[model samples]
Target: MIKLFLPLCILFLMSGCKKSELEAVNSSPTVSADKAVEVAAYEVEAPTPPKEISQKLLPDVNQSAQPPITPKKIDTIAKKIIKNGNMKIQVGDIKKAQTQVGDILKKNNAYIQSEQFQNTDVDDNLDLVIRVPHKNFDALVNSFSDGVGSVLSKNISSDDVTEEYTDVSIKLANKKIYLEKYRDMLRSASTTKDMIEIQETIRELEDEIDLAEGRLRLIDDRVNYSTLNLSLYKEKVRSSATSKIGFGSRFADSVTQGWNSFMSFLLGIISLWPFLLIIPILIFLWRKWKSGRTKP
Candidate 1:
């Protein structure tokens, strides 16, 4: 019993020592300073940044008074915020106003998602539909309204899509987890049938993930830009503002049109004069002889 106890105790101590050694050697896989050189490009093979670049790129890296950021850690976080809003604008001189809006959009470096412009003859009106990128949309629109000669009507609308966006994001994350689990299952599947089932489940998860991603993209695009449905018109100059033409002017126009028609009719008669001449001359001679016989 003593002999077995001695061997077992030694074995346990050896196993414990081995476990500690493994743990000490196998550290967690945080991105190292070397791997952060090209961090913006998302590469993992970067080396330690130079003192100058590190100071320039990451000023707070060595700050203990402030929140400390290690040289090896990710430098700064990137965040994207999305919101959807729209506007309705009524302005005078639609064409000129649209041109101004275009200039504003360009100045703001906004992407034109879509545009539609229509001119109406039924009434003196033009309709314009414009979608500008989300980032500078509100500011750009504000600047635009300032230049509008007179805003006959204006309206603004908004949709709070934050909750929906967050929902899809979380759902997509879970689907990725599920997809990874299914992928693992596929790799370790025993039977062919089991492998096929796992793959099928993975496919479903991928489809769901894709759908969620598409929705997210749509939300991102819509939120980034504001849509403006603008209606504007160039007012017609009414006849009351102008004096009527004098008698001389009226007579001249009448004479011009009448002379044109008369010339046209004379040319038509001359063209058929040969045929008319023969018929008229023959009738005249017959009447002359009849008159001469009656005189005798």
Candidate 2:
């Protein structure tokens, strides 16, 4: 009986120990502290970094090992677009030739940007500047050459603008990016002067950039298509008075003019009959002849 009692006491002790451990687990909110520590370590492993610092750090190591890039010979960008063309026509009348030219322009869907008509002792000329769509430019030029009797002088110019255009584009892109930053700063700025300054700078840069881009586009268009310049002259036609008259034509005109002059003189004398009374003796004689050379 004593041995059995002792064994039961040991079992009771073990059971009590197990129950206390279970109670401790139930009471504690942070269970499995090792797993929690592992999760927390994972969470704290990474942190967000500033953009500039990140970029500096992440640049390729190989690129850093290489030498700096060297620039090659840069081409000149044109200040203005290259536009050149010309046309010459020989015709009996410059005015009549211009009408035909107008018709041709309409047919080709082109327009005359400017024109000047001139005539001197030598000949007649029409100087014109016409603009046609890029697609139809060549066709219109060909037609102009075909229509004209001769081509006087042809000149062309080219503007190489690759470098200037590229530089401006790069500068424009950088300016735009900087301007965005300025805008962000503006939103948070407290001072009116600072805001106005930023706005003015952005406006000026935008205008300059727009002008540069426009000039570049124009230059590109001109270089892509060549232009032809021309001068036009027409031989003068003169008709003499003798040439206008055919056989006996001069004689008939003279006779007609003389007859007209004689009739005009007779009408003038009749119209002065009332005023002739002032001329005493002559008027009296005229009155006698008018009244009596008929009466007696």
Q: State the TM-score for model 1.
A: 0.48
Candidate 2 versus the native: TM-score?
0.46
Per-model TM against the reference = 0.48, 0.46
Lowest summed-lDDT stretch of 10 residues in model 1? 74-83
lDDT of 1 at 25: 63
Candidate 1 stretches with Cα past 4 Å from truth are 1-92, 133-135, 237-296
Model 1 lDDT per residue over 212-289, tens place: 999989887777666666555555444642457688888999999999999999999999978997998999999999
- True-vs-predicted CA distance for residue 57, candidate 1, Å: 45
User: For candidate 1, what's the RMSD?
Assistant: 25.8
